[model samples]
Target: MKIGLYFGTFNPVHIGHLILANHMAEHSDLDQIWMVVTPHNPHKNKSTLLDDFHRLHMVHLATEDFAKIKPSDIEFKLAQPNYTVNTLVHLEEKYAHHTFSLLMGEDNLKSLHKWKNYDVILQNHDIYVYPRLEAKGPNREAISSEQENVALKNHPKIHLIDAPVVEISSTFIRNNIKEGKNIRPLVPAKVWEYLDHNLFYKK
Candidate 1:
């Protein structure tokens, strides 16, 4: 079984997320895409982030109808500042039969070198990158070159996929909700209800 690990904060899971995951699963050879909800990301600010359990629950709601997509809270118990390489190691130990791959945007590729033990990740894991329209050309080129570099030694099985870039970000949705604006179609219905009931994203 091939699983694409789609890691994110997912403060509130949105449609854009579902679209990208679905596109990757439908277009690529991946059998399933798991939404690995991070408890805390070292790179991102936690000020506006919802609780980890809340975020994970929202993701579970948002992806409930989709059989190929499911939510994971594996990072919750891993300690503060969840790291990808560590998660991969844990997953490998827990699910030895599953082949894991990294699914991320092209922008993340620019900073892949900065990640903890990135070389080990590159040598052992495959990465699936989806193009982002908002990223600078240099970033895209860098991602392409990085893929090529990995391809040369057959090191990190990197693949660049063409998933539609719908710019509906959770940040934008949070901002809209903060301003008391309509966020009807931005997120899934179940997520909306959860957010509304919990008053999440309100400053």
Candidate 2:
């Protein structure tokens, strides 16, 4: 089976995430897209991150309606500072039958060479990149400044995809939560209900 690995902290899985996953699943040869919730990203600051288990649960809630999307707790079972290279290796060993591809935004794809053992990942697995605003769209200004991932030394394994645009961002949702603003529209209705009932992200 062709599985697309969609990695994120998923602080709270929202509509935008679902939209991207759905688009990938529909367009690609992926049998399923596993939303692997990383416990800790080596390059990202962990101070603002929610508990991994909590974030994973939120992903579960948000993905319950979609059959092709699944929330995975793979990183929780691994060592700290979960790196994509290590995770991919472990997944290949554990699930021998499944073929995997990495699904990510064009921004990340452009920065691929900077990641650990990027060469191995580039050669071993397919990388599916969805276009970013800077590449084609007029929405140059984002909710937060993501480094313009303009420099791309393309590898043979890379595959670019044009997933439907959904501007809703996870950072914007978190900022709204911090500012005591409503997150109803930012997340799916079920995820909104889960956040409300569980008192998640209260200031």
Candidate 3:
């Protein structure tokens, strides 16, 4: 099986995340897209993050209806400050029958150099980079601009995907909920219901 691993904190799984995963699963060669819920992202602020179990449950609720998408808690079992490279290594050793690829956005590609053992990741696995809208627009220029860096530019392992840009984000949904605004349009119906019943992000 060819699986695409989408790593995120998922503080709360929203429609935008589902849309991207669905698009990748359907349009690309990947057989499935696993939303790896990171308990604590080393690079992100942890103060505002919801509990790990709560975040993982929300992901399950959001993706339950989708056959191609799965909610993963693999990172929860791993060490703190979960690194992508480590997770990939573990997954490969545990599930030798499956081939895994990294799924990310153009923004992540631009900052790939900062990741732990980033060169090893690029050398070992395929990376599917989806479009992300920037201030100037879609960040498709990174692929070409990085050509001077022989390691990443035109790398066969990096595949740029033209996935549709969804402007929605978890921050937007959380803020809307905190302010008592309807977030039905921003998240999956079940997720919205879960958030409402659980009173998440309410002031």
Candidate 4:
């Protein structure tokens, strides 16, 4: 089996995340796309992040109906500030029969050099990079090509996928929730229900 690991903090899973994962599962060479809920991301600010278990549950709620995409809490048992290389190694050991690949946004590819053992990750597994709308400008194609050149440098393991880009973000959802606005269009129905029931992100 071929698995694509989509790792994220998932402060609250939103439609953008679902779309990306589903596209990877259906369009890519991956048999399954596992949304790995990272407990703590070394590069991200942790103060605003929801608890690991809560984030994991939100991921479950968001992806429950999807057959090819599933939620994983593998990083919960691992050390804090989970490193991608370590997680990949552990997963490889546990699921020896499965070939694993990494799923990420083109934005992340721009800064891939900062990640610990990034070279090792590239050497061991393939990386499927999906497009992300740039914040400063609308030139996605140019930015994507430039970032890909910097990160991949024609690496055979890196694959650039032309998937539909969803503009919604978890931060946008949270801000709306805090302002008592509707997030129905920004998240899965089940996930919206879960957040509403739990009063998550409420001020």
lDDT of 3 at 195: 82
After superposing candidate 3, which stretches have Cα over 4 Å from the reference? 41-45, 135-143
Over 72-120, each residue of candidate 3 has an lDDT whose tens digit, in order, gives: 9998888776678999999999899999999988776877888899989
What shift in Å separates residue 44 of candidate 2 from its native position after superposition?
7.4
Best-fitting candidate, measured by TM-score?
3
Candidate 2: tens digits of C-alpha lDDT, residues 116-164: 9987887789988887666565543331133334224344577778797
Per-residue accuracy of model 4 over 82-182 as CA lDDT, tens digit each: 68899999999999999999998877787887799998988889999887777236776666576666657478998988998888877888888999998
- Looking at model 2, residue 14 earns an lDDT score of 83
The sequence of per-residue lDDT tens digits that candidate 1 reaches over residues 41-104 is 6567778988778999999999999999989988887866667888899999999999999998
Which stretches of model 1 miss by more than 4 angstroms? 41-45, 136-156
lDDT of each: 0.85, 0.80, 0.86, 0.85
TM-score of each: 0.89, 0.86, 0.92, 0.90
- Candidate 2 global lDDT: 0.80
Clash counts for the predictions, in order: 0, 0, 0, 0
Per-residue lDDT, model 3, residue 44, is 72
